[model samples]
Target: MTTPARQPAEQQPAGPPRPAGRLVLAGAPLGRATDASTGLAQALATAPVIAAEDTRRLHRLAADLGVDVPGRVLSFFEGNEQARVPQLISALQDGQDVLVVTDAGMPSVSDPGYRLVAAAIEAGLVVTALPGPSAVTTAIAVSGLPVDRFCFEGFLPRKPGSRRRLLAELAGERRTMVFFESPHRIAESLADLAQALGPDRPAALCRELTKTYEQVVRGSLAELRDWAAGEVRGEITLVVAGQPAGSAQVEAAELAELVSVREQAGQGRKEAIAEVAATAGVAKRLVFDAVVAAKRGG
Candidate 1:
């Protein structure tokens, strides 16, 4: 007797689409206008209502797509997202599809659309997304560090102590990490990353991705910190190699080597420590310990 063949998983039906009068969180181009998806353009051109982080940018994007935005557009941003959600939800309840777009990237990832998305879900409104490029992922891809698993810490606190405290919390993270920082503070933040994580840890400074003058500089965190110190400009994304397992025990020896090499290369103690920790993919504390031990002949 012949046995019946099992059905392939690909044959499984994906359930029906959610109702139409829902909220669509769309992604805008981080840079390179062509990165916008077809679905995003369609939604922007025809959604019954468009909730944009920047209405002027929305209009500019519509012009780029050569499509007039006929929908009613409302400004929704960090300051106004919570307050504006109720009004937007009321539109969804009335069977209008609302599209939420940020100036760049997906609306809710380090952006202002999370509140509205949460509100819509609670209101039993269908929610969807229009996928697009993300700086977090893009920077990680080009960072030359392990990306099998990673975490995005977004922007760290502005204050030095607070920022250092946050980095301390992440000292044990084994997965690669991504962060965003302002151009003005990139130097200080990188120095902090070097100090907290380690000077020799591998990292990349991604600037103006996908735009003209797009640059990805891969070096030890300390080197990038020094480079940033001179004169840095543009939106910045930092991708750091994660802490290596068992790095603590061998840190002293590694850091000794770092100090020796950098000293020979003409870098001073502070600069050597920062570069060594960042390049070694270890913590700055480890480098500091090694430096102290070297001084004491331990």
Candidate 2:
């Protein structure tokens, strides 16, 4: 997705935005409360209105951090997120800073807060974040899989048919994937992923990350599925390796020919190589190497 070129400041309408209260998105730790950032602590201690996914968790976290939440605590979870966004926005519009926190990790990431954030933005309010530990990045770093280029799919579909359809669509994805899964559904999801992505596809199961019982299990999709069968538990983050490079599906000769054809049509080698890679859904390096090998062979 190419971002459109920004208009010149002079040419911009600017929406004539107003300055009221800002929305602070605070990221909570996946496990240990200590992982919370200082900014997060300060935000929790001082925000005038807090929209928490779970008020109980917020209180527990504050207790652990030895801070007091002087602000009015409001429940802002999935079930009530829609109903509560308006109220939170109202508070912000009244020049009262509103802090949004989820039970774990960043808000709006498979959690509550997106609606409120979007509302705040549409209302021309300032929005900022207190970043902290995220299971998606942590699991990818330790997954032993390629992480330079990856995508987070969040939680996999719960329904078998939906899950299967999604898996089928992702079968050829070349970017590493990260997903959140429940302990009960881990076994079934893994099995389905393996069946769709292939049994030998590399993957990792990260359970209770950063906690005392933290475990990182790296193996093939089939192996992870088997391990998940034997009493798996905890907040899970699964990292699966992407399908092998698309070059594997195309002969070097064919890849070289594709690039050459594009080059013949008034395209520079770099542009031709990029075009071939994009069309073939492969990496540029692979296509370049194939072109080089074909030159040597000739």
Candidate 3:
């Protein structure tokens, strides 16, 4: 009989090995403090270094979780993240388990942990995460739109022209889109979105997710734009459905009809172009070009 083949030690199944000074990115609660995971609490308690977007909020979370954060909590925010990453990397190199926590949601998802995480990974240090709740995912869940695939656009440009231009560029996006907008700008943004995307486009406006006063308004972009115009308040997350099939077939004739409809409804020429473009699932530039062409009798 042939002798049984001997397996190498590297091929043998073994118990989990200790991490080489792993970097743990912990997700903090979006609202209530009770949402933190047990693993996150323990990591916070035992980590040798803590990097937080907001130190005060980190302290608050530690207090709420009843976890004694023995490690020094250092500020790691947008302005300082780049400069602070090297220091965090050094700590990790020194065999210190560094835990990164953000003000809310997961660190690095529209939060401040990306730089340090990227740096640690580049340094060949083991990096892991203690997953927690995220407003982006939560809002998408309640949005009632297609969630199979989606793109998270943290926020639209503040300027109307820039925002419209950006929306125009997204006209051909095939996946559902998510956006974070301040309450003050939500109305204008929705209005611009409806004009750029089309009034009939399906969408949802999610507000104050996971909070006591959470609200989700689902409807066509036009209707939501109108709704937003009327005393809307709270943190906002907007979900817009993607372009529909054969949407590109909407020609100048159909665009003219759209312009006529909205023009009669008190929409300006520019706004009409935006609305038509959005409804037709085409670019605002296309619709605007058509409108200009129609005016020039092209």
Cα-based TM-score, every candidate: 0.77, 0.78, 0.76
Tens-digit lDDT string for candidate 3 (1-298): 8998987668667867545688888878888888888888898888889998989988988999898889988999999999998888888887788888888888888778887888888889998989998888998888888899999989899999889878877876768999989999999999888877778999999988877898899999999988887787777889999887577445555777788789889989898887777656567777776666676774
Please tell me which predicted candidate would have the highest lDDT against the true structure: 2
Kindly list the per-residue Cα lDDT of model 1 for residues 8-121, writing each as its tens digit: 777677886545488988989988778889988888778989999999998998889888898999999999988998999989988899999999998889899888888888
Q: Tens-digit lDDT track for model 2 on 185-272?
A: 9999999898877799999999999999999999999999998888987899999998887534555578799989988888999999
TM-score for candidate 2, please give it: 0.78
Clashing pairs in 2: none
| Cα displacement (Å) at residue 117, model 1 | 1.1
What TM-score would you give candidate 3 relative to the actual structure? Answer: 0.76
Model 3 gets an lDDT of 0.84
Candidate 3 clashing pairs, residues 3+ apart or interchain: 195-274, 195-275, 196-278, 197-278, 198-278, 198-279
Runs of candidate 1 with Cα error greater than 4 angstroms are 1-20, 249-298
Candidate 2: clashing residue pairs, number: 0
Under the 3 Å rule for N, CA and C atoms, how many clashes does model 1 have? 21
